[model samples]
Target chain A: MTQASSPPAVSIRNVAKSFGKGIYAFRVLDDVSLDIGRREFFTLLGPSGCGKTTLLRLIAGFETADSGAISIEGEDVTARPPFHRPVNTVFQSYALFPHLTVEQNVAFALEEQGMARDAIRKRVGEALEMMRMGSFAKRKPAELSGGQQQRVALARALAPRPRVLLLDEPLSALDLKLRKEMQIELKMLQEEAGITFLFVTHDQEEALTLSDRVAVMQSGRILQMGPPREIYETPTHRFVADFIGDINLLDGEALPGGGVRLEGGTVLSAPHNASGKVTVAIRPERARLAPAGEGALEATVVHSAYLGTAMLHKLDLPGGGTFLLRQSDPTEAAPEAGSRVGLALPAEALRVLDR
Target chain B: MSAALRRFFLLSPALAVILFLIGVPLCLMAWVSLLDKGGTSGVDWSSAPSSANYVRLAWEEDFDGTMILNTSYLVIFLRSVSLAAVTTVLSLAFGLPVALWMASLSRTGRDIMLLLITIPFWTNLLVRNYAWLIILREDGWVSRFVNMISPWPVQLLYNDAAVAIGLTYSLLPFTILPLYTVFEKFDWRLLEAAHDLGATRKRALLRVVLPIATPGIVAGALLVFIPCLGAFVTPALLGGGKTLMLGNIIQMQFGASRNWPFGATLAVVLLAIMLVVMTAMALWRNRRTA
Candidate 1:
């Protein structure tokens, strides 16, 4: 939530970055802009090489943008060095100082700020306790496990009470079970700290699970930016819909009469303004299955997978395209493999993406 | 064969070399250091073993057969120690920045610099000392240039300063190489962590880099200090024989004076000092780790 009278926590405008020069130059970020509200959990979601990390680095003052301005809490800090910025980063590798103990590492920034020694001790203890690393105060980072080290890194960054905290795939190193546990801890930590968190990750589930708002990036540009549900359910770009979740995309032609005609001569009455060749995306759970000759579309059931809570059926459409149906009702028996079945496509669920 | 016997057999060649090359000479030196001088053979093996030569280090017997305190050798020992310390400090000062710069270089650039650093090793140490002699001599251009701008005419050679300069120049690479190895493995991201934590560049260097590079610093100091303490050629040439170190005094006893027992005594004392320093360093390292 943002108040109109107050400035956003971080505002980035028209930032561009390029590496190298001459014929070998690579543009990593091009005209990227966004605003992170105060105390909001904002995530940059993208595959590798999409410049999400570069944008986070630029915001942290670790990098300089080729053009445009970055302001933190209404202060333009584009010309300042990282040391002058009121931001801290939880590095992907933790990057904990090996020679310093956990307590010393957590107190590093406070000491740099010239705080009183007693104050530093108090803050460091509190920060370590919050991360459940209070007992590891005198231990070196090398002696700690990877998850413990990550907690120490988070404590070190949060100890500074920075205006914004930047996390660069901080959980990508953990195992599946630990990662799930950490995701919940990270959300709770962000709420308790009350600082804007600008997280970067390629994991779609993590982005949706933890972020208040998600900005999906590709090729150095923000393809879509919205709440997780909005981005997931109403992705305006073809890349967003395909990247966000498992969806069935079908090639079709949009008629002037406001309906799409599939390649198999099947017409689905979905209201769209586009005409000529188009692509319609639908999530698997939005469609259902029926007995043969009972529904609008025809398909042959290829296989069925039990997903604990749901059954996923893979079917081959008449025009050679495959379709998916998520059957979550336990009472319904799934169609057998190689059996003819009727598939239902809802007009309200079909999303016509603008390429 | 048993594992222990097999291991002994595998290690026999190295053990035998150590015994012959190091152990035998040490035994011979220890025996010589306890005997008296012979009539002509330089060593009186039949003479009773005594601490006479060892006592000579602190008290030299006068013609009246009374022992008196001797400060001459003490002065020489002290000079050797302080000069070695100065050389080690100077080497660290010049080597650290060079090592840091080398570490920051690209792969090819680092290789080229490493090759350049090792280039001086190809030249003989004697030749290199002579080169320094030419550069520091009274009539040399470097001396002339210094004298021109100096408030008074300063003698650039035949002094402890000249000896220290020569020692540091010779042993600088000892410090740089070890320091470079530590710095080469340095995680530069730690510096970024320091900066992000609001540390200025100088603060980061002192607070983080220096502490992390402590092992290399101590190693470099030892490498320079040990050799500089027993340095003979640098003092002989640069000191011009007037400013004699322990090394020069020991050389005098063995060469012109031909006092074999006393020379052996001086060598033993030097080894004792080396052992003490090494032990102290090892103890300090252990304490830090603990």
Candidate 2:
């Protein structure tokens, strides 16, 4: 839906960063590299302490990388200070200036850049308008609600029109309804601004909803990078599959010529042609309950939850492991808990993670 | 006990101290100010009361309908206020950065620096003033150092400058302590936020850090300025009998001149100025917060 083949706005090349010193030194980002395209909405998704925020800070030049290079718009800026780099960040805490009005907060960067007073005022007005916070221009941050403050933070960061915007969990502080509203709003705003956004978030749903391409990371490394649908349906790593969504991970042995022999002698076609032991990953929404005599694995429905549109069932497989299933048809009756049923996991719906 | 009574009981000790120790002496001073002068020792309460002591502050009334404004006491008051203001400015300039640096330091480092700040307080202020007199007097090390630079020894001791130095040295802790407390609550993250907004370090300090620390700045100024206004010992010892601040004049009125009523009137004037300044500051602070 948006431009995807533009030149990269930022190029982080083999960048490595660590914290502490000597014996206590621990690498936070180990040989991490990525290209964020201009006008592309990119997200760094991972758990806490997974170096996602560290990578964002490194790009903003708030912290320098230990080795390798970071370039923005083909210009090397790894050694540059934060102010020298054409990048801005939306902090998790929404760090608006408590002493300043919303207009002054948004106009700060322009004022610092020595822009004309009239031009700074116009730009601040336009940014506030985009955030739908025009009337709140005179209000101090302490006088505003949390969501309103978050909008002010975004408006301030965007007022400078930096080459790239780095967001560090900017919506995590909002309540669920507001977070959902802002997720769609932020995605639309990124599209409208046409500037690259390198967002870091631990919430998988947030990354999936806002990002054009999501990079799933863990510890100090990027596990996989792809479009949201591709990342969710065909994850290249076990961590990615599990982190992205609820997935049933079954251990199986790969046979010669694109075949998998799961435990209990159940055979299924393989998506990958490699021959080795692999972790079979299946999403709950894809797995279906079939007649007992016709499915790949017989399972007992141990638990069922009616989730409005879909009925979720925790099925205990014949091989002693349990897998989750979601039946989307509301009209059909769900098999009672503790009743035996068959699960049909199509070959295309399963991914065997290798690395 | 009920919560209200319990709170009162908890506060009674401080209330008692303020009532008997501070309030009783103040009332006695007021009564003494209304009494007739008894030549050179104390006020004569049995003698008919008169307003001559208060009148002497600004005007000297002649029996022949001629009035002259005696400005010497007013000059001393102005001099004392100016010296205290100078000390306050100097202390804030020096103390603010130290407190900011201390705020940025590691906890143990800050504790050590605080200890360094506290250690000087353990020594007596009189002892410190006498030490400064030895160090800054003619033929002292400071004079010898100045003599090397110039042909003759500079008259640095017993001047306004020496008094200023003594006052700043004595009241630095008062200036620094409130600022340190203010800096403690300052969120260093605002600096990063400023940096992210394309603000240089200098810009950030002016726009962000300074505004956040204003409350502390105001508090430290009051703490330093009020005490410097009434400073007696440092100016007395370092003044070498040349400089006459309000404190010295007040001391002379009661100690040497034995004009108890006049001394009490001057004390009341100083007290009134302090109360007015404190009340104005508190009201301004409250309005801003509200």
Candidate 3:
């Protein structure tokens, strides 16, 4: 929280980009703007072709914006090439040179700067040690496993010690077990390095786990940008609520007395009374399974799934929709697969989204 | 049957074809290299097998008893090696970037480029060489262009330069195809990685792109060099009987001179040198990859 006042590490304003020329041109990034603070792990989260990777590339100076200013540490790098920018990228493929050893790969950026030989050797050694790949410094990329190659790529990018590091779906190639391990390692590493990380990924769990703040993008536009809890619980856009996780969206009307009136006149109290039509987004975990006729909405349990850590019960609402409730503590007298049940939708947990 | 025996049994037909086509002829050539020359009658194989043709290449048994170095044939062999090296280098110089460009093109564009390359092969090689002759002749288009620059129609038909240009042109597609295939599967993001690591474009081209493309370069070089070493029609038509390479001399031994044993000896020597160089290259490649 204190690091939020350390000034913006990267600021992009009204940036627009497109590919091709003339009639064939297709805009990839709309007028996107954001301010990422120093030492903050910021993520651009979206599905494929959401322009998240394109936005990350724009900040890295790989692509120039058609119009707008991009400032890194108060200096405009809009016209600079990637080599001239004080930034580095961990590419999606972990673009390690197959011909070069890990040590040479890590030392490449400093070597290009014409740094002192002794200093380069020391720094390369330190970077390799930091990634716990000191023993594999002499090995080529083809010889290392996928996870090791990812670590080596991380070491190479971080060895330059740029003010900000851009990671473009760097963990997408790893398997589930290794990806989980890398997610934890990457978050801890970013914290230790004290460098602002601009990560791009389509995985919501990864974004929520690693990012201090996330900007959910959809079709070249940012739908919402906030901390994970705010974005998940109080999503301003329906797209964000559905995309971040599974949600039960109920069409409702904003009542005048600080509540939402559903289609069947079931008024539920909420923090605010939005005018006109709205949608109530109830998170699966927040909506719980309760005894029959003792909860907010009466429903019948249609089915259930055992997810090892949590049991998901799919309930059919009385009016017309299905509400999914996730129960972590399975010790309660669980409702049978076809039993009558009710969903407890808390007033605070219910988010009123504008249509 | 064992796996090895079964594999050999399956490969016997191809091996038999190679043995009949290449190995049998090579053995016959080796035997012919050992025959002594006859006095206008024919090769006197009735006498005995002898190494005279091979020894005469180095130490000629002259009446004056002087063992002068056979620098003429040595020079011809060296010239062929140097010309082949130059042809390979030139082909690579032109082919690498062209192949890279072709690799960058769309699939249909690349297919069109490949079709254009194959179009050249539709014409007979002899006809193509003759076309070069007319194009390079005095008072021709090339000569007229030269006259505009130098006030004189410079001769470009009968020299090493003409042969070099012809060799590079003929073998360029050979070099380009292998390199095109290499760059086709290449991940271009490595260049971006190089740029992200502060390498300038030139540095990335040299350190990253060139190194990754070495195997393709070697494949292209071999394709250009091996054929250029024994290139017959190009030098024959372009040289105009002046700049005789080993190919023209070897042809002369078989057709005009009727010195079959000596020709066989020259073929064997050329084969030995190529084998040595190829073995050395294979060793170097293994070492590099390791």
Candidate 4:
């Protein structure tokens, strides 16, 4: 079934959060504004302690903003409590009731709504089947594996059919292989359920793979918001580019034209106009390595790391700055340690940011 | 020494202590329960092994039935259970909120409240029991103040009601401790998870908090019930012997009645009942866990 397109599921405007009073008070979230589209999977990607989870909690109505308005489906819900909000969260720890069986946990929200017994049974069975956990309905949470417990937690949240679903680092607890599998399953489930999803995670790969749009946050403020491709290819700030993916930042001064002068005194043209003291960022994949004396800057190979599919090389520039280059073929006759190398950076690949 | 010999040597002292302190008394009690009661003349150890004491309890001596049937005894037992249950319930009702409040407080505030809760345990149990008696007596200060305010004077001393009050007062802290232990460590995110799933405050408490707190409730109930069953000072002083309980009866048989065998038998029976109750509780707990 196609996902339904409606008005924005949640709209947060100028939200700020602070804890305690006076000297002890700490501001955790500052002037954060966001609009989560209906039936869209949106993710807040950031480093740890960046207030992304706080923003998710605010949208879920768990924490009230100190000053601002939160609206759901065009209705003002700034003062509403979590119970009154049409949102459900799959916590990082899952938070499954240890005392309850899988079935009882899945049926908790329905039971709270005072639904009919037969209806609850039917709905719980359907939810269990949806999560592929029908065989584990009688088992408690402690009996299930991490991935199974996570699926049970998801089923429990989804059974109530809330308009919006909040996921707070839902896959941070799983192994790499299991996390990848569950990520695909979670995306499929979100599509089938046709609900708005606000996923909070510090994993850039998870955000890039799952979210339709990603909001990169830093210290309680959204630094950049865009589609995954746009965010990765064209970051507005150095932090966003470095955080979203690995990049080598070179110290440079803005030239008279649309070019930058590297610290090594080599002039390179940039796609964007450089202003004041600037740093140019280029992805490792974008920089090409050649023999010394053939390219713009000559540098000696300091170290090389073999990463199965790709080989990463560390080069020492003449000006003492180091640059990292990635090559797919390690078996190729590459520069060995102490061997000098040339660095080729394309102008299109260089992004200039004003410091 | 060899490894096996050294291990045996290390275990010998504990085993010796267990044999002397526990095994010997248990064997003596088992031997006593099967002996014939020597009326007046003592030391009839050669009597045949029979169910005479148990049979006598059911048929010849109405003491067993009377002890079970006496309104005062039944009232005291029932009152003890109800009092302990009520106290435990009240403790949960009152203590849970206090614990939650304390849990939500700053570290210094939590420490202060915890210290306040623990202060009562420092006083002697007898002193605490007597303190209740002084406060609740007919001519006591509390009764005097109430009498002045009311048209009729309310007597709260030397009665089953007084025993109940004392029992409840004595066990209030016991109930609060376990409830506090569980509630203080309760993860608040679970409540938030429940609310995000659309449960109201009352619904979340009933569905989430209560089930998780069942172990604490059970522990607190046993802490109150088992002791209140054999409680002596509270009933003897506050009950004035008019509301004699099982413990007082056992005490009478051993102290004044001079029936050592009967007292031993009653003690064995009380121990058996307690064992049964504890065993049932353990089985229930195990089943729930399974």
Highest TM-score model number: 1
**How well is each residue in A1-355 modelled by candidate 4, as lDDT tens digits?**
1134654787889999987899998888889998888888999999998999988888788887899888887788889898888788899999998889999999998988889999999999999999999999999999999999999999999998988889999999999999999999989998999888989999999999998999999988999998899899989998998898888888889987688888879887886665778889988888998777776668899999999888999888888878888987877777789998888888888899877
Candidate 4 residue lDDT tens string, B9-78: 9999998999999999977776776776566633247788766656545444365544232254345445
Score candidate 2 by TM-score against the native.
Answer: 0.92
Q: What lDDT does model 2 reach? A: 0.89
- Tell me which of candidates 1 and 3 scores higher on DockQ: 1
CA shift of A181, model 3, Å: 1.5
Q: lDDT of all the models against the reference?
A: 0.93, 0.89, 0.89, 0.83
Q: Candidate 2's residue-wise lDDT over B199-270, tens digit each? A: 899999999998888898889989988998788899899987778887888899889888888889899889
Best by DockQ: 1
Q: Which CAPRI tier for candidate 4? A: medium
Q: Each candidate's fnat, in order?
A: 0.79, 0.87, 0.92, 0.89
lDDT, residue B16, model 2: 99
| Candidate 3 C-alpha lDDT tens digits along B33-115 | 89865667445566677887887776665579877667778778888999999999999999999999999999999999999
Quick one: ranking by DockQ, best first? 1, 3, 2, 4
Span of 10 residues, lowest total lDDT, candidate 2 chain A:
A1-10
Which portions of model 1 miss their true places by more than 4 Å?
A263-266, A275-277, A293-296, B39-41
- In TM-score terms, candidate 4 sits at 0.88
